[model samples]
Target: MRFTRLAGLSGIGFVLLLLGGNLALVSAGFPTPSDAVGFDEVARLHADASDALRLTSALLPTAWLLATIFAAGVFAALWRHDRIRGDGWALVGLAGILMQCVAFAGVGAARLAVATTATHDPGTASHDLGAVAGLWGLHNALFGFNQIFLATALLGLSVSGRRAGLVGRWHAAVGLLGAALLFLAATTSPYGADGVNPLALFGLVGWLLWLVWIVGYSVVLIRGVEEEVPSALATP
Candidate 1:
């Protein structure tokens, strides 16, 4: 199969892996960043769910790899259009996707550390609440900031793809809307770190939109259909 086709498949794989990881996390009763519980509670939860946490951690690397490939495929598809030649929006989108991979690596590491620390010695982990809390904070911070990269990817690709006539106007609109919400969430993330807050809602809604947009985008890529560019826009 062509690399392009493989990349399209990888996009769906990425989504599936992400969904599986979330399911594992939910099944394990993992706390969200917005959970207002004390560090001791956090440690206990981690200790109880160590296996599930580890499993989630294991899924992340493969998901990030697939996400990177999908971004490259998007860039390849968009960069060929004359409208985006000098703007390099597709390249920016690719960079956003790559940066997310790097940022999420930190998230996975923090989660794994919590799982390891909590499971090894529950008493000791309780005693070292500060360390565990720090790790959890790190995880939350990374998770919050990662939305910025997602927003960047959405903005770059949506604008360029729309200009290139590679995606429908509604698709581009969804991307733009998602970008705005995610960016808002990133900006307000600090306020939401400790517990449930209004700021978290922005991220939640944006993430849902992101899932939708990515699935739609992936289907479009798999179809490999490029609408005709207008004569005026097609001119070099």
Candidate 2:
């Protein structure tokens, strides 16, 4: 029970960290996916927002850690349920979350490299716009592909959770809708390699839905802790 409550708190913490990091990046002039810009422009942006970029990069690892814990908690909660048992959906969801952590690590590394290079090695960055652009492309690709993992997590968890009676219909619907949009976004990712594509709107909307679904899930976990305790004490 205590561990479940801790997991719930970790989920909330993960959401807060992600929200804060993104807001910081936006405030520091991080470009949106729809904003097409050249390598020189990319370098300039990174240089200008070096502090925010570095800070966000540093914070993301912790967020990912919390995400892993939350996923594990969810899996534990559903593992013994008859509907989830032998289905492996909980494991699938856990795998998806873990993969997202790996994919986003690459994204963060690319961003941090660009920021560091632009800030500390301006001369090199100026002479080699090609390399800088390559980094930016890598970042965009990773970001786009990362949505696939998010979709997978949503699908696996929402479906299994619903069957186990751990997720309400509305919550499951949100997850399914978010999953569809995110999967569509991933399919169109190649077109957005340059970081400018109208299809990116699917990703944007899906990401917002993902946030809402996670918050709802976190609340469920937190509330479950209260409900489980009374039943646990009465058993045997």
Candidate 3:
């Protein structure tokens, strides 16, 4: 009898998590200020702070692992909604995300502390340079790949799952696009030496697309779930 409508309820969580996290990141990201004539005052301070800064910087990807979890969780829910067959796949995806978060938390934290200890402060010239450098590696790229894979799986689930149907398809598509963009984020502009990383903007935009997709789908799915179809025999 507990015919709870998932359309309105849990789906909204998906939207908020994606959107809220993105907004927080954007607002928090002020860029590494570079305007130090001489390292007189800030030099020692920056060097002193390197350890702490490094730890925090390293932990960023770990922080985003939550988003990865959220992404996997969202996709898992989609599996349920779509009535897809791969509950096991969903579980594996979830495990990858959870493990990724837990494993990276401490590791990234240590790195961040170092970065924090290195960079004096954002106001200083060499704000997050070293920290940014640490992120340019295979691990970041691999993690980014995981995000894209999750998105694609969800989109595929949406298309094939009968429960969600057309509405679900659209939802999956948007979410997938968002996840795809996440890959480019690590290598984009700031992370890359090229100065302009398209993936950077695309990643954010893609993630935002996911937020919008979930919100829009929540409304539609709720309505669909609540609707009572009147068959031909019941027509008065």
Query: lDDT per model, in order?
Result: 0.79, 0.82, 0.44
Query: Ten residues in a row with the worst lDDT in model 3?
Result: 30-39
Over 48-166, each residue of candidate 2 has an lDDT whose tens digit, in order, gives 87977887888987999899888888888778677679997778788888899999999899998877666765435456676687788888889889999999999999888777777
Number of colliding residue pairs in each model: 0, 0, 32
Candidate 3 residue-wise lDDT, 69-88, digit = tens: 34444444446543445445
TM-score, model 2 to reference? 0.91
Name the TM-score of candidate 3: 0.48
Name every residue pair that clashes in candidate 1: none
lDDT of 1: 0.79
Model 3 residue runs over 4 Å out of place are 1-11, 21-25, 32-83, 86-111, 119-132, 135-146, 160-169, 179-191, 194-198, 217-236
Candidate 2: residue 105 lDDT (0-100): 95
Best by lDDT: 2
Give TM per candidate.
0.91, 0.91, 0.48
Residue 172 of model 2 has an lDDT of 88
